[model samples]
Target: METKVIINEERCKSCSLCVSVCPKNVLRISNRLNPKGYHPAELFNNDECISCGFCYLICPDAAIVEVRRPIKVKS
Candidate 1:
């Protein structure tokens, strides 16, 4: 089983709040800039996300949105 996370780059403020709040260190700020010219956050590995919701709740700008991906059943 694995988890996934998606980040909205334009909404991110690069405040590093998400980075610090992520106990799993799933979120990180990159040197890469968004179209809006602001540094943004990226997932270390989408599948590595634990869906802890720390990043989403801690974001001051409400930039981080967490989506959980449940493992599919193999019939």
Candidate 2:
């Protein structure tokens, strides 16, 4: 199974809660600022992400979402 992390940049409040709770260290504060003048969180290392949902759960602004793609079954 593969997992993808999607960040709603506009909604992010630049809080590090998501980054700190992420076990995989997949999230980081971006250098660029959002429209709200906040350094939104970004996915830095998606390959290492286990999709534990810690980041999503910890985000206060509902900025992060994890999507788990179904693994393909070979006949």
Considering every candidate listed, which one attains the maximal lDDT? Answer: 2
Candidate 1 has an lDDT of 0.78
What does candidate 1's lDDT look like per residue over 1-75, in tens digits?
434666788888788988898878877888899988889988876666778887878887766766676766899
Query: What lDDT does candidate 1 reach at residue 54?
Result: 79
Using Cα atoms with residue i matched to residue i, what is each candidate's TM-score against the true structure?
Answer: 0.77, 0.84
Query: What lDDT does the true structure give each of the candidates?
Result: 0.78, 0.82
Segments in model 1 whose C-alpha atoms lie over 4 Å from true places: 1-3, 72-75
- Candidate 2's residue-wise lDDT over 1-75, tens digit each? 344787889999998998888877788899999999999999887778777788888888888865554566899
- Evaluate model 1: give its TM-score: 0.77
RMSD (Å) per prediction: 2.6, 2.3
42: Cα error in model 1, Å:
0.5
Worst lDDT 10-window in candidate 1:
1-10
